[model samples]
Target: MLHKGEAINIAPNVVHWHGASHDSRFTHIAINPNVSQGGAVIWGQPVTDDEYNASRS
Candidate 1:
């Protein structure tokens, strides 16, 4: 887990998902270059409850 002030850089086009603990709050900023040109974000399938729950293990 990331500590305070730590950050992760995800390369463009890489698939990833981020979330916080159920009892805590989390926030982040996303900077997408040239997003005004369209298609800067391409979403994939939804993360299911089972999948999400398992990830916390």
Candidate 2:
């Protein structure tokens, strides 16, 4: 997860994801430029149940 003042730049044709610890919190801000004619930030698919379960530490 992103911390305070942290940022992620998802470039074109790029697929990325992040998450927090199972017992912690996760938070982030996504910005798209295409959506505003600059570029697009598309949130593709949701994390599958198996993916989340695998991420637990």
Candidate 3:
């Protein structure tokens, strides 16, 4: 489990996504060092709650 002030490393091409609680405020600082090397972010459609829960099992 992640605690406050902890961090993790994620490499390229991973299926990871980010989110926040419905009533909470949050922020993120993203740096794309790969931008100059022809790297681009891959975008996908947002998954519905039903789809997310189904994947959990």
> Each prediction's TM-score against the native?
0.59, 0.54, 0.54
TM-score of model 3 relative to the true fold?
Answer: 0.54
What would the per-residue lDDT of candidate 1 be over residues 1-57, giving only the tens digit for each residue? Answer: 878888888987788887665455678777787688873888778867876677467
User: For candidate 2, lDDT tens digit of each residue in 1-57?
Assistant: 356777777668787777764566777666664676756665668877777777574
Tens-place lDDT digits, model 3, residues 1-57: 456676676688786777554444345455668987876677678968876566446
TM accuracy, model 1 = 0.59
> Could you give the candidate ranking by lDDT, starting with the highest?
1, 2, 3
Compared with the true structure, all predictions reach lDDT values of: 0.75, 0.68, 0.65
- Looking at model 1, which ten-residue stretch has the lowest summed lDDT? 17-26
Q: Pick the candidate with the highest TM-score.
A: 1
Model 1, which residues run further than 4 Å from truth? 45-57
Clashing pairs in 2: 33-39, 34-39, 34-40
| lDDT-better candidate, 2 vs 3 | 2
Give residue 23's lDDT in candidate 1 (0 to 100): 55
Residue pairs in collision within model 1 = none
Error of 3 at 28 (Å): 2.4
